[model samples]
Target: MIFRNLNWTKNGLNINGENLNHLRFADDLILFSEDARTLEIMLQQLSDESVKAGLTMNPTKTKIMTNSQQIAHNELIIVNSEQLEYVKEYIYLGQLISTDGSMNKEIERRITNT
Candidate 1:
């Protein structure tokens, strides 16, 4: 609801330019972008909106994963003046998404867990 006025990411697959940039289920929010710059902008906007709504983002619980072909070792994304930790893979909605955009590890985990 806080991002109603914000611009979303476009996948370039639609003729009307309508694409999903983020997903909201309950209190969890997942934002996606093709580049770090755009992602950072989105994060900053989220942070600002959260503050305006009397909410705060937990930096420790925030994780960033990139699927870029060339990994950036020095890329830093800041939220509320603190840098978020970059992870090789992240679990969202019970699915593991890796930096390389592969689900092989996620499948293995699911099998092992089952």
Candidate 2:
């Protein structure tokens, strides 16, 4: 697989015994990896392939979020030499997801928007 790292050193979030590494919906994509190194490798490979297909990913538009405390705040992932931002919270599939994995913000957003 292009996205799967051969020597997997970490695992992503597992739900009901399923380890999810990525999710793609339409034009939106989310990558999951417990190891920062693995995530970076996947992202680099994706960026390279996208370039080969005549697509350029906007580094400014890309964001990274991590729930693990092991990941340092300064650990920013760069694509095409531009650094991506690390966000504490962001909306995914119209639902707010926080790096801390809190649902409070999403709940409040739903209440106000509903």
Candidate 3:
């Protein structure tokens, strides 16, 4: 997608002072951003670009998660004028990620699942 024009998450693995954004695996895409506004912009841009490429984003299946402890309430993320679902925890690449940035739940899940 043509999402390079929009701002993205720059929180990990800085290469020469450049931050990396998101992780793509197969058909799944995970976008990351520290702020809700940036994420909102990115999501909107992605939706627009995907439409141009004959692809559509499923608002129902799309979810927004944050690892910020300061955020006590769920933030509304809109795409295509629809509000995306906000989840406190999400499983990505078989790893559980929580809004509080703790792996305790993930570990417990794995243990129970096993």
The TM-score leader among the candidates is: 2
Model 3, 14-50: lDDT tens digits are 5678776677787577876667777788788878887
Tell me the lDDT of candidate 1. 0.76
Candidate models: Cα lDDT each: 0.76, 0.76, 0.75
Distance from true location, Cα of 68 in model 3, Å = 2.3
Count of backbone clashes, every candidate in sequence: 0, 0, 0
Q: All predictions: root-mean-square deviation over Cα?
A: 2.9, 3.3, 3.2
Model 2 stretches astray by more than 4 angstroms: 1-19
Per-residue CA lDDT of model 1 for 1-114, tens digit only, reads 577756664521233657657777876778777667777888888888888888888888888876675537478887778998888887877888887777789989999999
- What C-alpha lDDT, on a 0 to 100 scale, does residue 53 get in candidate 2? 69
Query: Looking at candidate 3, what is the lDDT of residue 44?
Result: 85
Question: What order do you get sorting by lDDT, best first?
Answer: 2, 1, 3
Give the 10-residue window scoring lowest on summed lDDT in candidate 3.
Answer: 5-14
Predicted structure 3: clash tally: 0
The residue-by-residue lDDT of candidate 2 on 15-89, one tens digit each, is 788777778887688988876777887788778777776776777667888888888768877777888788888
Predicted structure 3: lDDT: 0.75
